[model samples]
Target: MTQLVLHTHRQEHILRLTMNQPENLNSLGFKLVAALRASLQEATRDDAIRVLILTGTGKGFCAGADLKTMNHPYAPGEPDVLDCIVELFDELRNFPKPVIAAVNGITAAGGMELMMCCDLIYAARSARIGDAHCNYGIVPGGGGAAILPRLLPAAIAKYLLFTGELLPADKLQHYGLVNAVLDDDQLLDHATTVASVIAQKSPIGLRRTKQVANEALDKSAADAIIHERLAARDQFRSYDYREGINAFLEKRKPEFKGY
Candidate 1:
């Protein structure tokens, strides 16, 4: 089967993108990253898809980059592994619709970086998460240093990076990194439910909300408001905006065509 599988049958508007490699814990080798990026790009162009859930098959969500594969010298004209990682994260963070991480198992090093890119995360109770780069005398090049601190307290983030110790899902959830910690069997179901709920909302509203909120993370409060105002003004002109208003006044569900 393909290393990456994009499933749209579970719901009309929710796309479930799964890493199909269970061996080596679905490591982010060149092929896997390339495959994932392709799928994300496809989702972006497909208006029918409004939400995404990223997860892995078997026991791991992603165990970072496949160091064995990465150990080889880069061929001439080939992008480095770090470059692929950066590209992947950029796509994840900038994805217009909400993306949820359904972490199933061992999540470490670059694996943690992958999970951090999602808008929300729900992990199995037995999942372990952390930055393990320091343990191997390496530092993270996948935005772990920058992203972890934003998701967790500075002190806690520092400890994880300095020690390379994996923490249980419950611990990270306490730090507000993981949105929910659930039994292994419940992880995907909960993520699906959340994605479905989000998919039911106005696509125009969802896109604008996501774009503005993500931009707010990097801007001053004043700048963020200015951005939001501009985005809202544009959104108010969309067909979905009129549909939403008409649905509200007519007491009916909006049939959003994602315009």
Candidate 2:
């Protein structure tokens, strides 16, 4: 059987996960979701993997959950589709390492929610994105209603949610939804380039920074500052911190071991 997801190591420390199943527009199926979740679990435990890049193959990134299976009645003891998606999004949102979404093509509904879970997003010029849930009369169970508003202006988010119309990648970038929009051929290359730069940073430092950044979203300014201060104080005592300081003083590159 063919793999539903393709895992490729890039620039040594970066792992690129390509959602396969082009025939289905890389829709999330039972096996595909399981494979993705398993990969995330393994990557979290593997210190050598410092960064992750998520994308899809063929003309579409992800069309969202497989509607065929989604509408089917679940067998006894089988997992609920919403529950599985919740678990997947939760794992992705709390991922310690940097995760970049390289949206190469169509991204709709849950696919858009999945992309939002990443730390940063880059898109191909030809990519189109939207809530798309309204079109199918399906309510978004992932981050569409919740996280979308926080990520973009309320009006813009609502527009996407209410209209169910697809917008080009550049338009989303204008609304601050995407970090950058590159040429179709340059999407993966650009994402990998960014991941390579992040991979060279201290792993422990990146982990802590990501943790603090995620926390800041829900925290008051003063509270977030306090949290950041505490984390920084603790980070100052780490081996990687000392190595970084020493390396700077010695005018040499730091070889971080991720502590």
Candidate achieving the largest lDDT = 2
Cα lDDT listed for each candidate = 0.88, 0.91
TM-score of every candidate relative to the true structure? 0.95, 0.96
> Model 1: residues >4 Å from true position, as ranges?
1-10
Model 1 lDDT vs. the true structure? 0.88
Residue 61 in candidate 2 has what lDDT? 88
Candidate 2 has its poorest 10 consecutive residues by lDDT at 2-11
Model 2: lDDT of residue 189: 90
Model 1 per-residue lDDT tens digits across residues 172-255: 999999899999999989999999899988887888988988779799999999999998899889998899999999999988
Candidate 2 structure quality by residue, lDDT tens digits, 1-259: 6564655555699999998888888888787788889999999999889999999999888888888887778898988777788899999999999999999899999899999999999999999999999998899999899999998899999999999988999998998999999999999999999999999999999998999999998999999999999889988989899999999999999989888
Show the lowest summed lDDT stretch of 10 residues, model 1: 1-10
The local lDDT score (0 to 100) that residue 210 gets in candidate 2 is: 91
